[model samples]
Target: MSEERETPERRRERLRQEELKRNPAGSIHGGGLPDLVGGMGWKFTGILILLLIVGFLIYSLFFR
Candidate 1:
């Protein structure tokens, strides 16, 4: 039917609109910083922090 046919761009826009309706905050603001932090979980975040600390210690000992 005519209603079922959509150009690819129009279909993508339609899907984007539906996503906005479902997650207005994320759709509008690119999910924000909290979304990124929450998605990483405490374990991964801790590991990242540990690696940064180790890297900083190595840099200070060797380069400075």
Candidate 2:
């Protein structure tokens, strides 16, 4: 009997496929975070980041 080790790319592809089968919505192409922020445009992302920073500052100053 002969055993063949899978390549890195093949292993990643297999893992992605299995994840897709188990959780269709959670599987990400190319094995990274989804491009939701990229698709949202720079202006929107900047605004979101600014809001998060402001919110954190406010919470730290007033709530904590």
Candidate 3:
């Protein structure tokens, strides 16, 4: 067989080159704020709400 076998390093380099080709130089990483919000979505909202509730409870218990 005349085909050359790809080694691990070669495979990694190939993948990186392919990624670079797909993503242009001007393109930014991730989806920025909207992407983060969408990815976190309900989970982040629920956590923040829960934290606020717990903090209020703690404050009320100690200061009221």
Candidate 4:
């Protein structure tokens, strides 16, 4: 029996097709934006505190 060898392009295309099947929209690159505003209690509170600190700094610089 004779074996058939696949070309480099064909092998690459096959791998691309398999990857597309596994992940239709490709892979996510990094940790996405956190849901600080709408997440659980501590997360929301932490974000609020950070915003308050920033606001206080701005107020001190411009208003006071």
Candidate 5:
């Protein structure tokens, strides 16, 4: 029986997979904040910003 040889691209991909398995957070940044914002759809983001602006206006009118 002949052993299968891995191609260069396959070898590179395999090494990357092994590295990821060893260090799952090898490419993480900002500790999940980016993930949270990315998962929020544009519609939700728009509504959230609108609500914040309205709340700030109300607070300024009453407290300032």
Candidate 6:
């Protein structure tokens, strides 16, 4: 490596480029569904919904 140190702007640019390389052009974040899938994925979401539905049904049957 060269003895010359990188400036803040240059280091920031290099990190930005690396981040772009890691993510695709259409990568999105922070919406409800996007956050859901990003964290636990669609399969987990489906399972969770299924359990909630089953729990609700059992609660209604016995308590209501």
Minimum summed lDDT over a 10-residue window in model 2 is located at 27-36
- Residue 40 of model 4: what lDDT? 41
Give per-model TM-scores: 0.46, 0.47, 0.38, 0.36, 0.48, 0.43
The 0-to-1 C-alpha lDDT of every candidate, in the order given, reads 0.72, 0.67, 0.65, 0.62, 0.68, 0.66
Worst 10 residues of 5 by lDDT: 29-38
Give the true-structure RMSD of model 4. Answer: 15.6
Off by over 4 Å in 5: 1-33
Please report, as a residue range, the 10-residue window in candidate 1 with the lowest summed lDDT: 29-38
Model 5 lDDT vs. the true structure? Answer: 0.68
User: What residue runs in model 6 are displaced by over 4 Å at the alpha carbon?
Assistant: 1-37
Q: Where does candidate 6 clash, by residue pair?
A: none
1-64: candidate 2 lDDT, tens digit per residue: 1125775545655666787799976644543533456346569888998999999999999987
- Relative to the unseen true structure, what is the C-alpha lDDT of residue 33 in candidate 3, on a scale of 0 to 100? 53
| Residue lDDT tens for model 1, 1-64 | 2447886545655676788799787656485654555557679888988998999999999997
The total of clashing pairs for model 1 equals 0
What shift in Å separates residue 3 of candidate 3 from its native position after superposition? 42
**Candidate 2 global CA lDDT score:** 0.67
Per-residue lDDT, model 4, residue 41, is 59
**Which run of 10 residues does model 4 get worst, by summed lDDT?**
30-39
Q: Model 3: residues >4 Å from true position, as ranges?
A: 1-40
lDDT tens readout by residue for model 5, 1-64: 1226875545655666688689988756542544455556669878988998999999999997
| Model 5, C-alpha of 15: deviation from truth (Å) | 17
lDDT winner among the candidates? 1
Clashes of 3: 0
* lDDT, candidate 1, at 26: 66
Better of 2 and 6 by lDDT: 2
Ranking by lDDT: 1, 5, 2, 6, 3, 4
